[model samples]
Target: MTTGNFPRCNCASGALLQGVELAPGLPALQCPACDGSVLKLDDYRSWQPAPAAVTQPPHVPEIEDRPSARSCPACGRLMQRHRVGSSPDFRVDHCAPCQLVWLDRGEWPALAQAGLAGRLAEILTERWQRRLQNDEIRQQREAALRGKHGDACLDELARIRTWLAEQPHRDELIALLRTGW
Candidate 1:
């Protein structure tokens, strides 16, 4: 989007952003061409998500994910991307210094569908990022284990691990196993 008096879109779409209410009372600058939105964190903090009867994620074929780094519409600086969820995984572009968030087309709807609409602020925190990283790493490790050991062996190990957690002498049992027979 074009930039001058108005905020530009971070998507490099060359369209100037206009004011719009993404949700009731939640004001945001929206791009006409790309349908992307730029919203202030301050506005988001004061706004509430509309309650939905549906609890499942929307059937999104694919949400537009601009994998490349985007500039902040407000500050003209590169924004940092924060992972939101694993299913249909997408990242929200954030400018922490400017307190702004850039949501690509359909990103808001997807986030809301995934039950993460209310946790936008939480997604940008260090703890959340670390948790997301750990989760991805764990998934990778599991995939490797499954590849090498196969599903049956992994499933059995998981079952044993669960059973071992409830035993009174769990440490002793583990030690005996470590020592063989």
Candidate 2:
């Protein structure tokens, strides 16, 4: 429900939506009544940061079975629900066609606290997909190695590999091992 330039808050009807500046030039519609916010994708995407370096395996987010979906303030359409990070409890809504996002009370702060505010676009890219595939492959390889070699041999092999990886001649060592040296 919308009236004039005011976008209605889905959390509570009759709540007046106010224009707020989230950053220097980014504007968002905020509901002072319930603390919910509506941000356009283009507006929110302006704050996107460079993709962070992944040191280890990607952390999989724990998704919960949340049934409720919010309506988009821009189009009155049912917004798509998405989990922020590893926490399944918190969810935000996005209307793809309208390019609008709805954040419930405290969701914005939660995203910021999780360091996900500036990296949302990066997480949905092809690089992220490739990382997930690599993680799956690594897990499968580990399971197979453990099953065939047993824990002791697998542990020793892992230690040896770690040492080899640290060596300056790691590529040469790998090449030699592949040739049955």
Candidate 3:
């Protein structure tokens, strides 16, 4: 139940985290002083059941971003921060090589409420990562486009693209528009 004597709570509790067995063969270090817990990703994944199709996604409350850095208790190294889901809030610290995750106070319960606790694998999927990258790229491109063409021209371009979709030579017109000729 100990990861090399026990991992101290990284949230400045200065208290030794208690190792708790969430499931058989699945152990997690919980902070006695706070709701924070350090979980082994492999254990959590094994404990999680297969994701079911959700008719409507649960609403996740927006948590404020804290300007604090956290380290992996196992390795004593700075952990990378990532949002739990599509929400811009609720960041979690992850040590990729160690496969360990640090959940802040209430973060785990929040994820459960949001119906994402069982689907932690989703964030680790290639498809999800690629989609995030694509979305960022698209945002950057749109910002650049707006800067270069202005809002009015961008609106006009949108209208033109809509109209071009109805035209026969859509591709040719689009190409010309792209070239600005």
Candidate 4:
């Protein structure tokens, strides 16, 4: 029963909405206009700010200059264009400071309510998240192996670590390790 600006279906045209906490820790917002739903905090925090208009580092780039249609719900700053993943056409206005995303009227519903865009976004985001997690795990394993063994074994351990990390089911690997594999 907290109040805050939340992401809405861009298709809803700026409708005020309410959020319902479904479970102990899971909460989501329901758009009154389009009935679109989105996870509250986790989804909100995952949003990265759009790069500034000036110079950018190698991994980040400045988004195209576009007139903002709406202010960010979280920060009240003007939203800027942000491209998701490798899709050039999949752009949303994002606040650089607060990491809030503002979808134009109808954009949210078109992406979330219809299910196609939302599914794609969820799949892509999950894949990316898994990849990141795997990378972190791999790095940790490499660091541990390097510390215990020598650099000579690092490459061999890296190959095995990569294979282990890519396994869809990690329980077997974890159990094997727990048993002194």
Best by lDDT: 1
* Candidate 2 Cα outliers beyond 4 Å, as residue runs: 1-6, 47-67, 123-161, 167-181
lDDT of 1 by residue, 1-181 (tens): 2235446665547777888876677888899988888878999998877675124444543578787888887778899999897653499999998898999888887777777778899999999988987998999999999999999999999999999999999999999989977
What lDDT does the true structure give each of the candidates?
0.81, 0.67, 0.70, 0.49
Q: In candidate 4, which residue pairs clash? A: 9-108, 10-105, 10-106, 10-107, 10-108, 11-106, 11-107
Q: What is the lDDT of residue 135 in candidate 2?
A: 76
Consecutive 10-residue window with the lowest summed lDDT within model 1: 53-62
In model 4, the number of clashes is 7
lDDT of 2 by residue, 76-174 (tens): 888877655444457677788887777776666555556666655554455754665677689889999899989999999889989998999999989
Candidate 3's clash total is 0
Better of 2 and 3 by lDDT: 3
Give me the displacement of residue 90 in model 2, in angstroms: 3.1
Model 3 C-alpha lDDT per residue in residues 106-175, reported as the tens digit of each score: 6665766666666666765567657776887887898899999899999898887789889999888878
Question: Higher-lDDT candidate among 3 and 4?
Answer: 3
Q: What's the C-alpha lDDT at position 110 in model 3? A: 72
Give the winner by TM-score: 2 or 3. Answer: 3
TM-score for each prediction?
0.82, 0.59, 0.59, 0.32
RMSD (CA, Å), candidate 1 to true, equals: 3.4
- Collision pairs in model 1: 1-14, 1-15
Estimate the overall C-alpha local distance difference test score of candidate 1: 0.81
